[model samples]
Target: MPDLVAIASPGRRRQIIIRSAASCSPLGGALARAGILVLPAPPPGRREGSPAGEGTTNMGLQPPQGSCRGGVPWGAWGTVCTALCCADGLVYALGGMGPDTAPQAQVRVYEPRQDCWLSLPSMPTPCYGASTFLHGNKIYVLGGRQGKLPVTAFEAFDLEARTWTRHPSLPSRRAFAGCAMAEGSVFSLGGLQQPGPHNFYSRPHFVNTVETFDLEHGSWTKLPRGLRMRDKRADFVVGALGGHIVAVGGLGNQPCPLGSAEGFSLARRRWEVLPTMPTARCSCSSLQAGPRLFVIGGVAQGPSQAVEALCLRDGV
Candidate 1:
């Protein structure tokens, strides 16, 4: 009865898999409501690309039900937050909105071994939808929205030290920006540059600017003007693959969502246009496994169920 499940994706290296939460009951009647069931475990020595048996871990306790199901503990439950699985197999939940729609500074971690969540030191900045990247023991959180407006607060949490660190804020205010790690740096890509003190009378607009936070230098560096993304977009799905940062479909200046895709090469130090997505979309959920970056359900004309992936091999 486990809600969250990780399974090996088919036809790939078989070493990497995608973890997703279960959303529906297979049997939709009284049998489904029994509140008790068994989930088979993956058979030992099973071949890759094979289907996984219906499975749930037997923690010796019934899976949580009702609103409590898939819900975070009291301190970390809210919308527009980021939940990321680190190399240590722990789920780290970062800044999000609280019940009153106010931003929260709280940080929490889910311990699957004990089937419980533990609170951690709160972040110095309170905001939701911040882009986060895990580098070594530090989790860097970048710009996120505060209510309808965007904030430039940048922060990080040290997993080993059990402490929080405030880094230099983003040089500019950007909402829906994409964050990725490449070549020992945290790269922040295009987004809607909102109006600020310098542009109070101007309306929010999309930008193609790119910036990077060097892990070694410990400072933010704006890429040269020529290195900016070719397309002006916000809320794009971005991931680092094959020594390049790939930006998938997202909202652009057009009335419809964008389908164009582009990649920024770390070695080349410039943006290059790539193959367009089969389906145009924005605000899509993304997952990276090995060389493939999966772009899942997102808005098109309406709510969409499209799923597509971009793969990189030998710098192709």
Candidate 2:
């Protein structure tokens, strides 16, 4: 049986609980204590020596002390940054809001082998909540916000050259959009479209606009009107799976969060409704592993402990 390694937090302490993926039965002892809130997924290709249902030592990801920018606590780097593991197994932290709530242009890379962080060239556009993708040899950063206002900046960082290159900005400004790459194209999905200078008095609203940046063509193209997402959503979990783009729970036009899910088939060129998510929430962290898209902790009334995965139906 395959073992599932679950990262759990009980009280203020973090623990790793390993168990059978099929049974999910507790292996007993102190490791099986209750109040496990969230599950932070291990990087893909990680392996364990223990058999299924055997708990491992209590381990957590903690940056080396005095290793962050200016020797500040790693937690001091405020939330809302783009952190992703590259092909080299190194973690890269890109533009985000600083402790003072100002947008930052800093870029830092963490080497797990050495257990230390090192700085790289700063990004050309300094913003937070940007959509990023690791595509062959470069990391593409798309639309992001500056002090609650969206910017059209699009840039890329060359991993080999260690330099930043400016690309064509987004066709329109959007915040909290979902982005994923498939078949040599970068797809930008639903988000909240804020009002511009011409309509500054208008309220911000959710949009279902869909656009794609063709890497080979070096340009952006908006999908046809009929091909847009069925639901206007923002802060959702999206990923590419089985020749389709799946979008999970997020904030819609309603007072409560949306539980609806849908998938856009690249071959069919239309969005198909999927089963509703078990938990209705927004602002969740997501990670794509093979055919599974894991949506982790988010808000459901308040902070939610729900960790759910949206998988494709059998036989596609």
Candidate 3:
């Protein structure tokens, strides 16, 4: 089962493993058992060899280690459905549902230098189940639930202006969707939808629609079938890697969480199946720290403190 390490890579560890396997090591057998056929290491004084269309790195298989309190502070109550982003060397914890089951518009920023979270101006719309992505000096909040149904409202918070401005709304409303910014565009991926009369899709099924918004053009276009995600997932973690958009661990057609993952190659315009997450959970938070992507804190059987990451590259 130890060999399953390759199969059970959470996020950051998988990235490290993919890059760290530059040369053959004693771990070859275990990796082989995991179904990974590693290429022989490059000769000394030579560049490392990797899969075709892949780049070289110098990372290791070491996993991320550390923990922080889940709760924000005495005055700031903790809640689910939160979104996070980094700007100007600070982390922003965005809107989420409060204990009353009402979506909150509160915005809080964490200062590492001060080791505390401070409040910012509230969002124009109170939302839950929304996904956030940073582009330039602004933070874009995508589709999320306003009440029992999904919301199409799209808005951006300008870091420099300290204000929220309405942006083009989503063509189709969705909640709990996975989102990421790559190549000057914002992608809104799969999530759950409410069934309505006259609609063909029934039972509140998961959506496979993939839409991308051009930041410069201010337009949204749905990706073709060939470019869609391999899996229909909601509440999953998503991040940009090697110019690819990777989706990991979320709810699917099953009752339990999914451990599966996939990545969309910008170069090839195809979805590549990646290793499944070590754990499966919903409503978890994902963030990019430098070249690594992290999934932290969510519900599996119950509240979870588990933290996982993927180094997008070997050296960086």
Candidate 4:
């Protein structure tokens, strides 16, 4: 497990302490007894506002933390290949397709501390299967299918500047690709580039190619192959635990999604399969919050809201 460290911003005097494993501190015990933590503020902060302050009337409670856990409510609907972005102390969920049939442009922000969700302006392009990465305060949404065909267009949303700008299109149209932001570049991995609405079990093949776009150079370069399977999504997470970028469950061109999980060694330029997920899924979302990786909604034989946790002890 990685060591816990507290990062404090000099200007705001606010701090965030992350631990590899949840602590059993006094605060944690108190929170567990209460069953809920109440941090009173002005009805939670909005995405388009200044940093919230700690006021006397506003009390923040620290919940009893524990290692990650997983459980799924069977029959739950509304699953899509969504991107999760974390910036400025909040996590923002970007574009995805839901049960509505049409791609969603809606952006939702969640504040874990406040246990609340805030809806923000939708993306200019309503798209599903797109991937998102953060460069400083800006968030970039890359290739995914739009309308009827996979698109290569790219757009970025600046959190600090509060504006959206169009970037150059990807070299090719791809969806369900693995995406990771590292060393100032967004690395996109293999995905399907079908031209029509194909279900998960469709025979569309997965590409083994790896391509990366340099933020500074404004150019894309295809990297050497690391894995040969198709439909395997990349990165699918943020932050590094166990000194690796974890890629979770995805399907190949095979009839069903694969339970296999893998991690990329950025320094080594190699891939290592981790412990397989309890379930096989594709088009799912994986989030790295603190030390655990949460594998959220995705499609198996059908859409699933099944949530699972991947721990370091179980992987490379």
Please report the candidate that would top TM-score against the real structure: 1
- lDDT (10s digit) by residue, model 1, range 20-69: 22322232232224321212223333222234442323322222222122
Which stretch of 10 consecutive residues in model 4 shows the poorest summed lDDT?
A: 68-77
* Model 1 ranges off by over 4 Å: 1-75, 83-85
In model 2, the runs with Cα more than 4 Å from the true position are: 1-85, 313-315
Reference-based lDDT, each prediction: 0.67, 0.67, 0.65, 0.54
Per-candidate TM-scores read 0.77, 0.76, 0.69, 0.60
In candidate 1, residue 82 scores what lDDT?
48
In lDDT terms, how accurate is model 1? 0.67
lDDT by residue for model 4 (254-288), tens: 67877776666666667666778887776554445
RMSD of each: 9.6, 9.8, 15.2, 11.4
lDDT of 3 by residue, 129-197 (tens): 677767777888887786777878889999888899988888876667878888898888888866654
Candidate 1 vs candidate 3: the TM-score winner is 1
Clashes of each: 0, 0, 4, 1
lDDT of 4 at 154: 80
How far residue 207's Cα lies from its native spot in candidate 2, in Å, is: 0.7
State the displacement of the C-alpha of residue 69, model 4, in Å, after optimal TM-score superposition: 36
